[model samples]
Target: MDNNNQTLATNELATLPLGHNWYQKVASNFEIIQSYLNKLDTDEPEANNLKNKFDNMSDKLNIYETNIQAIVNILSDYDVPIAIVDGKVVEIKEGD
Candidate 1:
């Protein structure tokens, strides 16, 4: 049983998904948002509020993406299944 499990893990590792360039696309989008925010009048009542909100959201996104990348890196180094479905990790058994 242990040998079979090891073989199954090896096969699954061989099928790991390739990395996507989604980070580049997301960075480009953030640049566009920053440009729009820069065009706003600094003295406007809502300008500061909008800028603060945008900054907060940008920080959160950075943290989220960084964490996700780290998780992927660690997972790729092990025998765990990298399959994620609907925000849940899917584990495969020997016969499944």
Candidate 2:
């Protein structure tokens, strides 16, 4: 309802766990598909196409993982109340 309340709510939401588990599951699935593609006979043109698709998917997944890690790092820094702990800002309790 107020600025402090809004800030606290935002901080709480920001600290929620990112979907690392989901990303890992999708990545694992991609690995399985790629393995299957590799075992297939290379003479078939469709095999090549499927392998290429898997390669592109792997690359994009890597990029996504990196970006997610960066976001998590940034959020980890924000979770620490550095300004308040360092005495740069005082946190006033209600009724104080």
Candidate 3:
């Protein structure tokens, strides 16, 4: 490839965040919760109440996931290198 293309690719790579495991873990937990909720038989009164609670929880989780993704996208657009450091989102500098 030409030097220009190489530089562009490098810049893009530099902007990309280093960590995704945190997001993946959150997504996995959401999946697990949904899976368990799906297995419940909501015909019984107690089960129905529990199902309603789970449904609400699922909705909140979905909203949270959406917001997280939006933030990630915004950061990516601005070429910010974000990562989970000490249980917080931190910027990673080049060569650090």
Task: Pick the TM-score winner.
Answer: 3
Tell me the tens digit of each residue's lDDT in model 1 across 2-59: 1222222234444555585555555555666555556555457687778999999999
- Residue-wise C-alpha lDDT for candidate 3, range 1-96, written one tens digit per residue: 112221122334444577734555455556666555655544468877889999999999989877876786699688878754564567888666
Q: Estimate each model's TM-score.
A: 0.39, 0.38, 0.42
8-86, model 2: which lDDT tens digit per residue? 2233444556853555545555666665556565557887788999999999998986776666556547663222334
Model 2 stretches with alpha carbons more than 4 Å out: 1-43, 80-96
Please identify which of the two predictions, 1 or 2, would achieve the higher lDDT against the true structure. 1
| Residue 81 of model 3, lDDT score | 82
- The runs of at least 3 residues in candidate 3 whose Cα sits more than 4 Å from the true structure, single-residue gaps closed, are 1-43, 83-96
lDDT minimum window of 10 residues, candidate 3? 1-10
What are the Cα lDDT values of the candidates?
A: 0.61, 0.56, 0.63
